[model samples]
Target: MFQIFTSFFIIYGSKGGCPMTITKKLVPVIIACCLLFSLFLPSVQAQAAAKFSDVDPQRYGWAMDAISFMTDRGILNGYPDNTFKPGNSLTKAEFTAMLYRLFDKYRPNMQEEDADLRLAGYADVPETHWAHKEITAIYDYYFGGIAFAFKEGVEEPFFQPEKKLTRLELAQIMYMAIPFADDAPGASCQVIMGMTDIPYELFSSYEEADEYRFDGRYSEDTGISVDYYVSEGAPVLYPLVLVKESDGSCSSSFDDYSSIIESAVASMHTSGIMTADDSGYFRPHAPVSRAEAVTILNRTYNYLKANRNLQQYSSLETSSAAAGTPVTNPQPEPPAGKPSSTVNPAGNVKTFTRDLAVEGELETMIDTEGYRSITVSIEAKEKVDVIVQLGGKKSFIRHEELPQTIALNGIKQVSLETQKRVFDLLNRDADYTAVLTVELK
Candidate 1:
């Protein structure tokens, strides 16, 4: 275990009775005091103009930033009473409208009303509903492939437009919809609980949050342990926070849906997209208010916009539903019917050398079963961290492992989920050249 930094952001303030204390032993008290001093500075007033009485800029500074970002973009606004009810539960209809607003702002072409929307087929959401257009555009037209909100039934699909959105649902939806920067890789070996020669990457002594476990830790027959690389001067023990991992039992706090919501909660917490309560516990079952939802969306939109790249890799099967993956044209299905010849046909193996963008994706999609093999080779300039998706499964890879060949065995489908591509770049304008080859047998 390495001495990794804790994920929680310390709260500092004296407004609305917000806590001015640090209970977590790992959090340095000096840091909290510095934050307290910064709150009263004159420069912060501009950022604190969130205008919401309920959200104190000194206490919940991040909330203010989120609100300001959204309002400035004309995507969100305060209530008529001049109060942002940050704690009020958000309804499904409202969330849809918020997402549509973002879509309208970014994709101006989607602003027109496509009166021929096929949402009338949904049993619950009728065309006459107030949010029908917004819902149809995002749920039916934009995110039809992912369909995270749809509940399938025997007769037809249903959208619970009136139901309140929960924290778990919000986290899962945001993770699926927005692209976030990946955490930097930490040093491999460090001291864990004063134990020397301990590896940080692989840990078995205890779990951090049960719902979120990365590949760094694993279990052995003798006992649980960690595996990590040995880097000079890196922290040994990574901070492991307490999460629901002891028992697999579901909690009513999640309204009897704990099992399904657990992973999303952990992912959000770990990714810094969502934070825990004062007690450091993520209330997975709590309802997400409209203000909070807008804040999340605002943050997500900014992240996506900042990371957009003009260079993209196509021909690879990529999922439109993947977070932050731009969707323009729908994927065309392969022509029906197998090849007239029963022979196993070989595909054209072509090699091309091009500049790969830092945030770009290299994808290949195969619609014919005749192609059974794919080999890709690249001479990467840097250690680029990328995710490879085959069928529906995903695996993390680095550019260091390139100049290698990948053979698809007993694999019939390939789809790359478009999340953020992590790369070790020297600068913003940096581009790496990779030689790729694709062959089918």
Candidate 2:
């Protein structure tokens, strides 16, 4: 069409078949047409590249780019009828297949002779299963001290491939796949434990606390054999602290599962590899849709492509050692005659302020003598997550609840959670700072 139009214009203009005024007008029209054609060419090509029958542009527009990217690379495929069922829930087997394709470079090559030997372990994922190869491949690659999709509490050794994948599970897979620095999981747990809010006087009586006690040995989910207490009176039971054994190691039945989920979700959320919904909530237990799965996988791929130095967790033994190690040492006291930063020296109550950038942190030692309560006011120019650490305890503040005050009943040395390497990788551009005010009463 362009060739014919150009030929007609050339012949008509050269022979004066068209008047100069008309020819001058036609020249601008030709240029305009060329510019418009150039602009639409890519869109046309893109549309032809990955067209799905069921995905409506208005509803699934945000996911179309990701769907297209994955489809083009053959990481995701539409149904035989040419429909991409974006709303359908993603299953474990399906996710493994997608991950196997997405991270092909990271996995080992499986030989036909060795396939049966490697795949023989899973009782449910038989040779007849559709995603047996993918399951085998992913299971062979260990992450966070276990194989892919490894779960506790199963009576028989089986891989439930047809089970719908949850948001938390996907986040965990991505977290393991990226394999943050060696200390990341531990540091993430610290942030989680620190952010947990438990009232100091919740369990007023020993009997009340005893009623919520759980021995770690009895809980098959978390194999740590030790006694610990939880606040069962609350809507959700919150693990308080692990009981210290004669070996000085703390033990608790509150498994690493919750911590890992929290850590994975936090890492994913902060890094923009995956994000929460409009309410700033990452529904960890919610079932993942096919569209959401691909979109997240696409983001993970892009992140990995850009970041080449990411260290993968090598040995399960070493990785396990990185998480749940107890800190048994007593918190050191603040130096005498040294006043707290920005605090009034003469009063029983002390107030101080510190400023920090996104992913930035501040640490200060406060003499908590005669103080029964601690309050922190966070003021940020934009919404941001902040971690406040007091001695061994930590608290996390979400952005939505920002420009607000966080009050804790007990006093501990004031500090902020500082996992610099993890935060640095998560957010590089630290242009703004959140102001935190600490007050002891």
Best of the candidates, TM-score: 2
The C-alpha stretches of model 1 lying farther than 4 A from their native spots are 1-50, 105-121, 140-154, 179-263, 277-280, 309-441
Across residues 108-196, which tens digit of lDDT does each residue of candidate 1 receive?
Answer: 11432432223334566788999877765554222321232232233444566786766655765654444332211110011111222
- Our tally of clashes for model 1 stands at 20
lDDT (Cα, tens digit) per residue for candidate 2, span 68-150 = 76776677788898888999998888888988776765453253233322333466677888898777666532232223323
Query: CA shift at 86, candidate 2, in angstroms?
Result: 0.9
Lowest-lDDT window of 10 residues in candidate 1? Answer: 184-193
Number of the top candidate by lDDT? 2
Which pairs clash in the backbone of model 2?
194-394, 194-395, 195-394, 195-395, 195-396
